[model samples]
Target: MEKYPLKDFMDASEPIIVEDVLAHPRVSEIAHTLIASGLRSFAMVPIAVGERWFGVIALGRNEPSTLTREFIRSHRTLAGQAATALESMRLLENTRRRAEREQLTSEITARIRETLDVETVLKTAVHEIGHRLGLAALDVRLGVDKDLLTAQSETKIVEREKEQ
Candidate 1:
C-alpha cells in the first residue's frame, strides 16, 4: 500500500491516468491487486482547493484504454467542484456554531442580570451554560475564604469610618 502508485499521486497532488494498470511500470507491483479488484485501468484526481487537499476522486475501468483524456478532464472538474462544496459546507457549519455560542452568551448574560442574588445568578449561569452545551452534569465551586472575607470587611469598615 505504501509503494502504491496512487500514494505517489496523492503526495504529488497530480492526476494519475494509467491506461494499462498491469503493464504500467509505476503500478506493476500493485497490478495483481488491481486485477483482483477487476480494474484494468484507473485514474485518480486530487480533490483540492489551492494547497489544501481534501482527498481523491478515483475511477476504475474494467477494460484498458477506456479512461480517455476527455474522461480524466471531466473527473478533474468534478473533483474541483467537490472540493469547493466541501469547503463551503465547513465554513457554514463553523459560522453556525459561532452564532450559537454568541446567542448562548447573550442569554446567560441577560438571565444573570435579571437577579441580584448571588445564588440565583450562579444557578442561572450554570443551568443556562450546561443546557446550551448539552452536558450530562455541571458543577460550580466557590472558593471564598473566611480569612479573606474578614479582612475585606475590616477594610471596608475602616474606609467608612474615615469617610464619615
Candidate 2:
C-alpha cells in the first residue's frame, strides 16, 4: 500500500511478518494508506537485521492484485541482496577514509625527513599534522614560553594572530 503502513509498523514495532496481511487491522491500515497514496496494490515484507524488524520492502502496482509465492520469495531475495550491498558500501567507504589518513601521515613523515632546517621542519610538521588529522584552526606554542596565541591556520599559513 504506499509503503507507509509497512514503514510505520516497522518504526513502531520489531516484529517480522510475511504471511497474510489482510487478516489484521494494522495490515488493513497499510493497505488503505497505500491506496490513498494512489497505489492500487503493494506487497510488504518485513526487513530485519536478525530478529529485529527494521522496515519493509514494498513494491507498488497500479492494478490491485496479489503476488505469487515465487514473486514474494524473489523480492525478499533482492531485498537481502540490497541490504548486503549497502553494508558493503559503508564498510568500503570507512576503509577508504582510514587508508587516506594513513597515506597522508606517510607523506607528511617523508616530507619532514627530506628537510633539515628547523623552521622548515616545524612548519612542515605542523602543516602535515593538520592535513593528515584534518584542516583546522591551530595555535602552535613552540619553545619553553608556550606563549598563548591565537593562530588560524589554513594549510601552512595562519590568517589571523592574537598573542596572549
Candidate 3:
C-alpha cells in the first residue's frame, strides 16, 4: 500500500513482493485507498549502478498474487537493463567533459605560443578559458618572478606590486 514503509524494501538489493497490500501490518493508513484502487499486489526491484542504488522499478497489479517467481525474474532483467543504461550515460558525460577540458588546454597553449605581446596573450587566455569552463570570472598572475606582479581578469587587470 502507499503508506507502507519503503525503507525495509529498498534496503535490500533483491526484488521484494507484497502479495496482499491490505493484509500488510505497515499499510494500515493506506489500506482503504489500496482497496479502492483495486491494487492487490506489488513488487519492487532495486536499480543499482556499480555499488550504489540509483532507484527502483515498481510493478503493481489488481490480482492478489501476481508477483510470482517468474515475475520477479523478469523484473530483475528489466532492472539490470536500466542500470546498464544509466552507467552508459554517466560514462558518456564524463568523456564529454574530459574532451572539452583537453581542447580548452590545447587552444590556450597554442594562443600563448602564437603571440609575443603579454597583454594580448593574457586577454586571450582569460576569455578562452572562461568561455570554455563556463566561468563568471577568473584571475591569472603575470610576471611571477619579477618584482611587479599583475593579475588579469576578463574585465580588468590589477598590479600587485610596484611597477618596474
Candidate 4:
C-alpha cells in the first residue's frame, strides 16, 4: 500500500503534498501514470471526523509547485465539512429504517387483533414479515400442550387437532 500515495495518506490521516510527482520517491511508481494524466503535482487530504475516517479528497495540478501549504490547509477544512455531512446522512438513514420497522410491527399487530382465527393470523404474520424482509419463503410454528400449529408459504396451514 506504500506504493500508493492515496492509501498511505488515508492510513496516516494526514495531508500529502507532492510538489513534483516525478521527483517524489513515495509516488515514483505511479509518477508516469500521473504525468500521463496531465498532473505534475497533487495533494490529498483525509476526510475524517474524530476517530472515523471516510476517505481522501484529492486534487491535482498540471504544473509543479502549485499545491502549496496554504492550498492544503484550505482543503483540510473542506474535508472536515464533507465528513460531517456524510456522518449526518448516515444517522438520518438509520433513523428512517428504524421508523419503518416500527410501523410494520404496529400494522401487523393491529391486523392480528382484528382476527379470531389462528390460521388467518399466522398467514398474515408470515406474509407480511417475509415480504418486508425480502425472503423467498417463511415458516411459523406454535406448540400448546401436545398440539402443534404450523404454517408455511408453499404448504399452507397444518394443525393437529387437540385430544378429545
Candidate 5:
C-alpha cells in the first residue's frame, strides 16, 4: 500500500476526483493507508510560474480514472490564480524594500548635507540609522574606486536611545 499519492495537494481547496482503490493500483496504494480508502483515480496540475516551481493542486478518486486534458486545464487555471497571488506578494515586497531604502538614503543625505567634514556625516548617519533600525551593527563599506569617502565612527560614545 502506498503511503500517499505521489504528491499531496496543499490548499487545493476543492474536491476534484472520483475513483476506486482495488482496481487502480496507483490510487489504491496511496489510499489504502486511510480507513475510508479505495480511491482509484488521480488528477494534478503543476503550479508553475515563470522559471520557479511552486507546488501542485491534486485530487483523487476511488475508481479507475485518467488525468485528462480537461482536469489539467482546470488545475492549471487554479494554479494560475495562485501564481497571481505570488506575483502580487513579490511586487509588494519589492515596493516596500525600495521605499525603505529611499527613506534611509533621504535621512542620511539630510543629516550630512550641511556638514563639510566627512567625520560629522559618518557619526550623524550611524547614530540616526542605527536608532531607526534598532540595528545591532551598522557599517559603511568604503571603496576608493567608487569615489566613496571614508566615514569613521567618532571616539566619543553616542548615548543610547531612551527606554520607551
Candidate 6:
C-alpha cells in the first residue's frame, strides 16, 4: 500500500482519519490509487508496545464519511488493548523458557550430588546433557593420568593407616 501518510502516522504512534482521500494533504499523493481501490475514507490507529510503535490497525470504507470523535477514541482503545495483549504474551513466553532452563539445571545438580563416584558423575552428566540437547550420541573421555591415579591411591593408603 499506500505508505505516504500511514507510515508516518504509525511511526509517530498516532491515529489519522482521512475524510476525503483526494483533498487530504498527507494522502493526496496516493488518492487516485486509493479511490481506484474503493477506499474513499479510512482511519488508522497505531499499535504501540510501550513507547515504540509495533504495528497498526486500519479501517477503510468505500463511501466518504466524517470520522466522529467517539469512533476515533474507540479505535485507539482497541489498539491499546492489542498492544497490552502482545506484551503479556511475550512476557509469558520468556517466563516459560526460563523455567525450562531452571528445571534442567536442577536436574543436573541433583544427578551430580547423587553419587561421589567420578565415573557415575561423568556418565550421568553426559547422558543428561545429551538427552536435553537431543543429541544422537555423546562421548565423555575421562583422562585420569597414571601419575594422578598413583598419587590418589597413595593418599588413600596413608589415610587408611592413620584410621587403623
Top lDDT hit: 4
lDDT of 6 at 98: 98
Candidate 5: misplaced stretches above 4 Å?
Answer: 1-39, 137-164
Q: lDDT tens string, model 1, 1-164?
A: 35445676464346888889877898888889899999998888888777766778878888897666787788888888898998898889999999988998998999999999765676677777777887766666443543111112111121111211
Q: lDDT values of the candidates?
A: 0.72, 0.60, 0.73, 0.79, 0.60, 0.73
Estimate, for each residue in 129-153, the C-alpha lDDT of model 6 and write its tens digit. Answer: 7788777666554444431211121
- For candidate 4, write residues 1-164 as lDDT tens digits: 33544585354357888889988898888888899999999888877777676777878889897665777788888998898898899889999999999998998888878888987888778777877778888888787886777777655554565644
Alpha-carbon error at 128 in model 5, in Å?
A: 2.0
| All candidates: TM-score | 0.74, 0.60, 0.70, 0.74, 0.58, 0.70
Error of 1 at 24 (Å): 2.6
lDDT of 3: 0.73
The parts of candidate 1 lying over 4 Å away from their true place are: 1-5, 51-53, 147-164
Count backbone clashes in candidate 5: 11
| Worst 10 contiguous positions by lDDT, candidate 4 | 1-10
Evaluate residue 89 in candidate 5 and report its C-alpha lDDT on the 0 to 100 scale.
Answer: 84
Q: Give stretches of model 4 more than 4 Å off.
A: 1-5, 50-53, 113-120, 143-146, 154-158, 161-164
lDDT of 2: 0.60
lDDT of 1 at 29: 83
